[model samples]
Target: MTGGPSRGARGGRAWREGHAAEWIAALWLMLKGYRILGFRLKSRAGEIDILARRGRVLAVVEVKRRKTMQAALAALTPHQTARLVAAAQQVVRGRKALQALEIRLDLVALAPGRFPRHRRGVGA
Candidate 1:
């Protein structure tokens, strides 16, 4: 049964890749003047890739990694976007700190040989 790496190993590799992508996305967001509040934040609805704030705005970010920019953008499906939006709302509902800030959905797309693409106000 040693034809190739096992399913668990593949999943571990994917997890590592996603982790690195999230770190890159977080750094990029910081560079753009956002203070990172959470990374890999789990909510009752779903997992939030990153939560960041700047001035009076709070950003709920979704990170996607793919072979190309188009593919990365396409990775964020409508269903996932809905889940992210719901998760953001559910997670922020009880937090007074975030309640005062304007909330927005953001995307950080990672592709090989290119800078991370950050798009604000996505899926709004």
Candidate 2:
């Protein structure tokens, strides 16, 4: 078999972690009755891992895969936070249905084999 970690192991690890975060977030959103509009939403600044809606509220979510809350908190640098906010604003502007919707930012932080912790209304 040609199975090995040498085929870009770092990339593989990142990809797997990303997929895990998405799945975890998606399941959580579904359980909460939020309709997921998109995942990995990108713009000139950065990516919003998940964009969802519940009632009249629009949620822009950023996903972080880390070993702890401290690590996840550190992962969101100021520059990264600015970029995420910019991208999310762009997303809001681009959707007519979201034009007048209440916007909120969310962070879904996860450690491998652990449940995700959600932080809502994160601001720039």
Candidate 3:
């Protein structure tokens, strides 16, 4: 009789929602003509939600879900941004296919009842 909900309960809900948002973002990118190279790619730097490519550009996408577009866009901080960039570098280093592509950090912000807003070359 101390806390609101157990850690597992809260974490499970968040994990499920994050996964759903990432899938939605991936589909949206596909429709826009990008090929998804990976999802939930993890490196020692951090976790990249999605890795997509179009022509010579490789997009390292970070998905955010919030009540509003503004909130979602504001969710990532400078430190987090740095980590994302570092993660993207790590991802490219590990994938020979990504070697020749131009890597960019992108943001895909999703809110309820709204299409995902994509911001390319963010934190670059």
Give the clashing residue pairs of candidate 2, or none. none
Listed per candidate, the RMSD to the true structure in angstroms reads: 1.2, 3.2, 1.5
TM-score (all chains, Cα) for each model:
0.94, 0.85, 0.93
Candidate 1, residues 1-124, lDDT tens digits: the string is 8899999999999999999999999999999999999998888889999999999988999999999999997788888889888898887897977888888989999998999999998887
Question: Candidate 2's residue-wise lDDT over 5-29, tens digit each?
Answer: 6768879888987887887887888
Which structure among the candidates has the greatest lDDT? Answer: 3
Least well predicted 10-residue stretch by lDDT in candidate 2: 69-78
- Candidates in order have lDDT scores of 0.92, 0.81, 0.93
Better of 1 and 3 by lDDT: 3
Clashes of each: 0, 0, 0
Query: Which one is best on TM-score?
Result: 1
TM-score of candidate 2 to 2 decimals: 0.85
**Alpha-carbon deviation at 3 in model 3, angstroms:** 9.2
Candidate no. 3 TM-score: 0.93
